[model samples]
Target: MSQEIQNISPIKQRILQFIAELGRSKREFYSLTGISRGTLESKTGITEDTLTKLFTAFPDLSPIWVFTGKGEKLQSQQNETSPLFTVNENIEDKLLNIIAQKDSEIKALAEEIGKLKQEIIQLKELLLK
Candidate 1:
């Protein structure tokens, strides 16, 4: 029930801070960022894959800060600005859940697209016969 992460590395600590500042839930962070809760909690250091997932999920987050504790927390023309999207605290969990759901939907759609592409190729081959 607690969002508290144990055995967290500094980078992971910063990641938790970023997620907190975003007004998002740990489930949402895990779902959208593709970083498992276990990995974030247990890993002692950041990896290229972790950084990629983090940056991809939250482009506004400053890589420099995530990596070296330097620069603003956000990256923009004026870095002092707030998060791009604001969620009502009452509905924050719901909205994040929806985001996670959407991510799953997108992945499913991508797989469907790949299947469709294969079907199309087969159809073309049949037509050529």
Candidate 2:
């Protein structure tokens, strides 16, 4: 673990531990949480917005456990045969959903940038007239 991860706040440490438990890379956690790379890696504390997104993106995660780290990582039943407790497919689905959302956001941003560029061109034309 890096010194930065070691020095992070309690909640952040929990988040880091969660990430480690999942065996996911930092990039994967940032993608899943919709948290920016800089904020995810550099911040000492986890913001509410990031926490909200994290829970929303991964509903299987136990918020209580994430906040306090005193209980099971998941809130579902302990039985391995239970669908509620299954990990692999559910995690993959959640990650896919997050990736889809990011794709949509990127598309929207691209469209907005195109509109802004057109407006800039129109303003330039008016100014040059």
Candidate 3:
């Protein structure tokens, strides 16, 4: 509710503040939303094509909320059984695979470090003789 935003139309204000919060340039918003310049221009009452370009460029927004503000701030829906929840299953599996691999690596490294420490201790004992 800053003074600058208070004066503008609500839709344009939401778009502008959302962009600023996302910490990205307008060009990035254009790429993210895939929204046409004309579409954005018609909705926000912003005459500058560059203004509309902001929506498409930013990645973190839910296009639904950005376009109509009718849903959650993010793209997630309310229904617990929505298919969208499973949309990233493959990506999640890949991440778990990577984490498992890293865990194995860490276990091996810890074992090696233990062996090295024992060797150091034996060497120190020899020196003490």
Clashes of each: 0, 0, 11
Models 1 onward score TM values of 0.52, 0.53, 0.34
RMSD of each: 15.2, 15.0, 15.8
Candidate 3 lDDT, 1-129, residue by residue in tens: 476556666666678667678797556665676555434324345545554454345444566675577776555443465343345569887678778879999999999999999999999999999
TM-score of 2: 0.53
lDDT of 3 at 101: 78
List the candidate 1 regions with Cα displacement exceeding 4 Å. 1-6, 77-129
Tens-place lDDT per residue, model 2, 1-129, is: 578776677777787777888899979888877887866566566788988888988898888788777767887843455343335567778778778879999999999999999999999999999
lDDT of 1 by residue, 1-129 (tens): 244555667788888888888899888889988886766777477788888998998888888888788888888733546553456555777678779879999999999999999999999999999
Please give the RMSD of candidate 3 to the true structure. 15.8
> Whose lDDT is greatest here?
1
**Order of models, best TM-score first:** 2, 1, 3
Provide the lowest-lDDT 10-residue window in model 2: 77-86
Q: Which residue pairs does candidate 1 place in steric collision?
A: none
* Rank list by lDDT: 1, 2, 3
